[model samples]
Target: MTVIGWIQAIVFFLLVLALTKPIGSYMFRVFDGQKTWLSPLLRPVERLIYRIGGVREDEEMTWYAYAFAMLAFSVVSFAYLYVLLRTQKWLPFNPQHFDNMTPDLAFNTAISFTTNTNWQFYSGENALSYLSQMAGLAWHNFVSAGVGIAIAVAVVRGVARTSVKTLGNFWVDLTRCCLYVLLPISIVVGLYFVAAGMPQNLHAYQDAVSIEGFKQTLTGGPMASQEVIKELGTNGGGFVNANSASPNENPTALTNLVELVLIFLLGAGLTYTYGKMVKDTRQGWAIFTAMAILFFAGFMLAYWAEAQGNPLVHAMGVAGGNMEGKECRFGISASALFATVTTDTSCGAVNSWHDSFMPLGGLVPLVNMQLGEIVFGGVGSGLYGMIVFVVLTVFIAGLMVGRTPEYLGKKIERREVQFAILAALVTPVLCLVPTAVAAIIPPGLATLNNGGPHGFSEILYAFTSTNANNGSAFGGLGPNLFYNIVTGTNMMFGRFAVAIPALALAGALAGKTSVPEGPGTFTTHSGIFVALLIGVIVIVGALTFLPADSLGPIVEHLLLLQGNTY
Candidate 1:
């Protein structure tokens, strides 16, 4: 890595780390009904929303009722979005006269965004009206992100509470998450995006006379609002077809920096929030520290790989290492490094294309996904995943020491550890096993856009994408109905499977009796524990993925430089 890259990485890392504690503290307050200066600003808006929407703030539901309500709300959202996409030509503000999406495609798109998968099989403007862009898609971006945050809060509350049957009021947590945390920040950033050149137009998509005199219609939207939360929530769907890399969507270097920061900020802070809620700031920072390490490591490797130039081109005397998939505007270092970090965290808004990556460069993202992205994985998802692993780490440590693991003075017992293990382990189970099955199935090889080791990589990537609930695709995979069914199943299992257990684990921990800190109490806040936690994270990822990665990237590397076709 260049000195600048190192500087960029370090400066960014510390900035994120510094923000995590206070933001996390603020988040805990938001969900738990604490106050900040921003609360007053947001509170009236909160009341207005409840009054307008018939949201009963005090009408708390039991866990089942809450879960059911979430499902119902999401279902309504999916239906509305699906209908909008399927009939946008008739909808107002559709200056482009976009055609209706195919039923399968519409379903995929709806479920994708509703689940916060934000998977785009179709381009935005070509498939959606401006009204749908704001009402259907962007609105869900806020609510979906709020849902994930609320779910995480519920789980934490479960852990912090004692013998509590109720995790929390779903309506309350969701409202506060949107009102106090997501909305305030998003509104400010959205305005910034507009000022930076992202379109906030009521104007229709119009035919633009190209320099070549070919009339190509241009697409624009109320992109600024969606663009803000899309990154902040780690929901990677793009406002335009080009995603974050879109000229209008992310106009300048400063906006680019803001986008990157937004993608990671909440995830990092949530780690500290976890620590704070548990009364151990050290624990949260440890998770954040580990994520920082993995992210930078990938960034360096991506930069190096791109800088090294493609070996195939070297043999053929082509000069560039790996710039094929990257936007020339961004160049190698910016493209590769940004992609590495983005994919590393399950924030899949690619500033560069993955398919065009030099084999090894592409492999980094694939492997990062397989690592379960717990190194600050997705926005809310990533932090929670890492914490789940931490719980398992302490549990394992406790087992080794013949004493019970206690995280934040709450004993990590059989139930807590079991659920934590479930949260940590299930994604891999969904990712790898489905990958194996998909690869062995007769139809699997047919999905590949590139053959040989790269083909194998595509199958692995597909499973990783689905099970990670990340909607980004390798340009190679033909994610047809078969792939869709498989991937959608993966998305559902990947999301709900871990989440339900995590919430359950939190409740279990809360019910447990606290053990006072003793000499043997395994101080999770100490630097030593942070290092150990990182060790545990690395070990889990490596041990699980060693062979799979060997078959995919490691072999692909040998094929690229060593001159093997397969």
Candidate 2:
């Protein structure tokens, strides 16, 4: 990576780590109902929010019940958002005279956003009105993220409890996730953004009369409020179409720094939270470190690839290499590193276009998506993905040692491994199957804005973007009804398919007693195990994508970079 890219990434990592511990610690208190300075302040509001939302504080549900509640909640959210997007023209604050989104487009968006996928088939500036943007899309950002975190807390409860019938109250977990963790962080970050000059108004869209006489129209909303959780929740959708890459939206360098930090804050903090929840902080740190190692490795590779520049450019005596799809001002180093980090983490905000990236540069993102997005993944989701790797690693280790596989205090039985296998395999099935089907279909082929081998990459990216629920796109697929319907179905499976099994496994683990941390207790937080964990994750990814990647990015690069036209 360039010095600047490394510097930016390192700075963001340190800052996020620093902030995550404190906030995540406080969140521990908030959810546990432990006394804290803000307990008096936030507790009343928390209680009131529960009452208003009709939350039953005393009620807790089993794993199945909690999963049901989550699905039901998402279903309701999808209905609300779809209706809003379809009827937005008549709602209000639509100064652009924008019409309703198409039924299929609205269906795609409703699913994309509510699942924390944030996948975009349609342009935000053209398709959505301010009312729908704020009330529907932005609101869902908070709720979807809340769902992820709630599931996380519920899973933690399963780990903590000793064969309890109930996991935790779904309503309570959701409330704390939203009110205590997401709400507070988002507000502070949102206010900081407003101070940094991002728009924060319910005002109608404005027509800006620029000094250079360029007629530029502006979109404004309760943008700051939405932006905080959008990053903190790992929900990468932006209030405006440009997402975080837009100058006005992410105005200053400091704002960029903060946004980067926000992307990882919870993900890093959740590590510590895991340790605390399981009464084994080291385990959390080990998993967290493993994720960190992978992230930095990607950051470095992305930097090197961009620095190599395009051989195609070099052949033409172009001054710069690897300039394709990158902002001239952001430069190769900054753009490449940012894309890698965001896509790896399920924080899909992009500073550069992915479609125009050089083949290897593009390959980094594709591999990240294909890897189940385990590198610092979504707030709750990334941690879960890595844990699956941890299980697989333990299983492999157990076979060698002639002992049963175990993690933390729980024995890793066939049932848990079965679920882990499901979690591990779910994303690939969603991505590869849809990609294969799309590349053959007339509509999917028609969706390609760019043709040839790279065109295949666009279709692959759409399924990748949707299945992974990482919103950033290659910016080439037309993604009409056919693409949307197929991709949306995959997203539902990709998200909940992996998650439900995770909760089920957590309960299964909870039923088992924590065996003493004997000499054999695998130190998941430390050196050898961490390395092994990463190796296993990489191998899994490589095995899954080798054939398909050869068809798309690898071939595209060979043809394009070698100066041969198909």
Candidate 3:
């Protein structure tokens, strides 16, 4: 709302724009199997990993093979994390001696992390020991993100390579993603976080006496390492209950900006990576431009709505922005920016509670997720998700022009369009069906912490978050058996259902030869296409979720204007 806030937001986007090329070019080399500066150091480790796993690095996989490898890897990751959570009390790093997670919570937590959802059903500091934090959760933060990037690279190969039956090997892409990309960047960012005064230790909770003579237990753990990747990888699970809002995790304002950059870093970079792979930098910029527009629009709406404050409070002659659920250090602008940024990607880290935002402000984050989180999206997920829309846009434009649709010389046909539509429809099915069932069922209703539309918003937000693979919550919904089981299932479906079909689309595209572009061919990198892409994304979200959104945040906003509170 303030000029300083506007300046900060502008500067943040500029920096991200600045970073897209360098980081993205490096990633292109990594995934394309070219040598980089890290090659000397990481090459041996990479080879050792393949040797131990008995993987053939020289081999490539068909689309089905790649999909199967991804699924098998996820299965192992889930089993490892689930067992680790259920047995962590007896594990080595139990400095706090926290009890083991129950089977249901463990099931949910494991699925949550492996799918890169990071949705927490319990407080991290209280429910997790040091070992669980590192081995169980942080491990997922690294690998799950790697998996997303790997899948995206596979999709790129499909688009870039013509008449090729093979995409890159899954193991090689996954390995290189971690070694050359995630690990090195994470080390640098993690040290900056530790310097910012966030905790990085194995010490147990300290017992302290307050000045008021009340006893308090100060929480501490291996937070700095987790904090960096939590943002960098767009896996936003916190090391504590309060998440980034916790001083021990986020610390200073400088750290806040740093974390924001980290959350957006790879996602923005991947757009350029996409361009580099497709042999068209303009193609990447077109997608990035659309994402930036959506992001700024959402931020402005949220900031303005929050700046307007509550009309009821204004009627009582108290006038300032809505600071109800925001930290004073962050103020309205930073809080609003954070909400939009985190939701813009699938990163769920928060500096302020979304649940306490004005109804319209709250609606923005919900809609971002419902739009398939493709507004710059999760690390690898965002670029691939936008590519889905790009396909749809090209198809729509083809219909308008009465010609076969072509993107980057590869014709977009019925098979490719079917796969894209299948992937696009997956999240809506996963989100809406479960949400409706929960609304009518007893156990689902049992999780409500508020009455009326606000309560309905919480339910809708939960399913949307899971279905989008976004982990942030509306905060009021209590954890229950039904939520644990259902949301976990939603998380898995959200991640893979779309991902597998995307890979299939990639394979289908990769097998075809590129056709020559003629005078009638539509340019996907043009301004008209960018506008069409954005319109398709917004319209699809609006038409699909308008009724549900009207019942929740829209109704709530109207009620608040009439000086009513739910």
Candidate 4:
């Protein structure tokens, strides 16, 4: 990649690093029930919400109670969104008079958003009305993210608190997350997006003649508001089919950078929040460092592969980086960076199509999701996901050293280890099993756009993305009844299967007393531990996914080098 591109990537990363502490600290206060600058304004509103919903803000929940609340909330969210999508034609904001979504599509879309996996099968502008966009999808963007953050904070409490059977109040944590964190930030960023030339209106799609003398329908809605949370919440459902790649959604390079930052912002910040909560900033940094290492490695590989372009194309007398799927404004570097960051954090927004990338370039995003997207993962999900691995890492370390493992002074015991292992296995089993079933079936292959290994990659990527709760698509496979149903199932299982187990682990840990550090205690915040953590994460991902990957992108890459195209 060009030097300018490298500079941009470095600056983007540094900006995220720079903002991590303040945001993390602010979030710490928000979740810990402390007052903030916005307390005066939001406190009344927060109280009113609790009153209206009949929520007891002071009520704490056991891990099972917390999971049940999250599940119950999700069920309601799914029903509301499903009904909204299925009946959008009758909805108030149907300026385009868009038809209602089919039962399967609605089912999939509902699960997608509720789980924070905003995987769209239909084009937003063409299929959804403004009411569905805002009242349904955008609302989920805020609350789903809030739920994720809330769960993470609870998990952290499990690690930090001793001899406690209760985590924080789910309703209160979710409320504070939305009020003090998501809402305020979204407002500011939404304003900036409007100022940066992205549209923010409820006007009808304007019909106009282009310079080419063709009529065009310029899509319009409450895009600015949705666009902000779409990234800020790591909810990548685009207002239109083009997603962030669309000019109407992401208008400029600066906007693109900002979207990238927003995706990683809270995720990176949560590392610090974890550190602060655990009374060890270094622990958070150690996790941050491991994530950073993976982030850079993925970005560098993607950038390099994209820069190398397609050798087959080069044989045709073309040279320079592969710009096939990338936007010219952002070029290879920025697009690669965006892909790396989005996939890393489970934000599926794309400036470029992964399917158009060289096989190896496309492999980066695939592998990112397969690694469970814990490299600065989605909002609250990333921290908890990483912590799952951390638990496993320390357990493995404990076994090696012939001592019980301790994390932040809490013993990582049998129940915790079992739950951690269960959480870790969710991705591989949910992803690979469905992928295998789809690869050979007629219904699954009906929409396949490419053949051979590349086609296999597309299927593999779909299952991986959904199972990771990462909504980005690799393209090629057209969404059909089969995909909608299958991926929808994957999304639900991926989200709750992992989350409930994590909460269970947290609950188990919460009931335990903290032990004093002994000579046998493995220091978790050390460089050696970071290295081990990375090793555990990498090894687990590699062992589970490598064979499937070898059959898809890896084989495709080798084929491409021999001037073959699938």
Give the TM-scores of the predictions, in the order they appear.
0.93, 0.96, 0.99, 0.99
lDDT of 4 by residue, 1-566 (tens): 77887898899999999999999999998888889999999999999999999999889999999999999999999999999998888879788999999999999999999999998888998889999999999999999999999999999999888899999899899989998999999999999999998998998999999899999878889999999999989989899888888888989999999999999999999999999999999999999999999999999999999999988778889889898877778889999999999999888988899988888999999999999889889989999999999999999999998887888788888888899999999999999999999998999889988888989999999999998888999876898888999999999999999999999999988898888887777899899999999999999999999999999999998888787765
Clashing pairs in 3: none
lDDT of 3: 0.91
What local lDDT does model 3 show for residue 78? 100
Deviating ranges (above 4 Å) for candidate 3: none
Query: What TM-score number comes out for model 3?
Result: 0.99
Counted clashes in each candidate structure:
6, 2, 0, 0
Q: What TM value does model 1 have? A: 0.93
Of the pair 3 and 4, which is ahead by lDDT?
Answer: 4
Native-referenced Cα lDDT, model 4: 0.92
Candidate 2 segments whose C-alpha is farther than 4 A from its true place: 208-213
How much is 160 displaced in model 3, in angstroms? 0.4
Would you list the rank order by lDDT, best first?
A: 4, 3, 2, 1
Clashing pairs in 2: 286-525, 310-322
Worst 10 residues of 1 by lDDT: 60-69
The Cα local distance difference test for each model comes to 0.76, 0.80, 0.91, 0.92
Q: Write the per-residue lDDT of candidate 1 for residues 1-566, one digit (tens) a residue.
A: 46765666667667777787778888878876777788667788888888987888777555556566666777788788889878877878877667777877777778777777776767786667787788888887888888787877766666666655677778788888888888889989899999988988878776788888898867667888889988888788888767877777777766877787887888877887877777767667777777777787787777787778777677887776576766655667767766776776666777777766766787788777767677666766776676687788888789889986787778876777778787878877888888898788877777688878778777777777767767666756775776766776677677778767776676666566666788888877667777788778778878887787788777888877887774
In terms of lDDT, which candidate is stronger, 2 or 4?
4
